[model samples]
Target: MSPPTAPSWSLVPDDLLTEFLSLLPVKSLLRFKC
Candidate 1:
């Protein structure tokens, strides 16, 4: 049996997500595809 799939690190914490994204490099952030 396969394990359940988990959300990726791209799924950062709400506040932290925004904070992280705000600080992410343009190239790396572009890979997020919004």
Candidate 2:
């Protein structure tokens, strides 16, 4: 049997991701990006 695979966040929709990111403060988001 094959090994179990890890779940990926890539499966999340771009719009959903954008919404979450938009909820963060500009400074916090900038720090996270870096």
Per-residue lDDT of 1-34 in model 1, one digit per residue for the tens? 6754766754667899877777778757678876
* Winning candidate number (TM-score): 2
Clashes of each: 0, 0
State the lDDT of candidate 2 residue by residue for 1-34, as single tens digits: 6754734556778898898778777769789899
C-alpha TM-score for every candidate: 0.35, 0.43
Cα RMSD to native, each candidate? 7.9, 6.3
Best by lDDT: 2
> How far off is residue 31 in model 2, in Å?
16
Instruction: Give candidate 1's whole-model lDDT.
Output: 0.72
lDDT (0 to 1) per candidate? 0.72, 0.75
Model 2 alpha-carbon miss at residue 20, Å:
0.4
Kindly state the number of residue pairs that clash in model 1.
Answer: 0
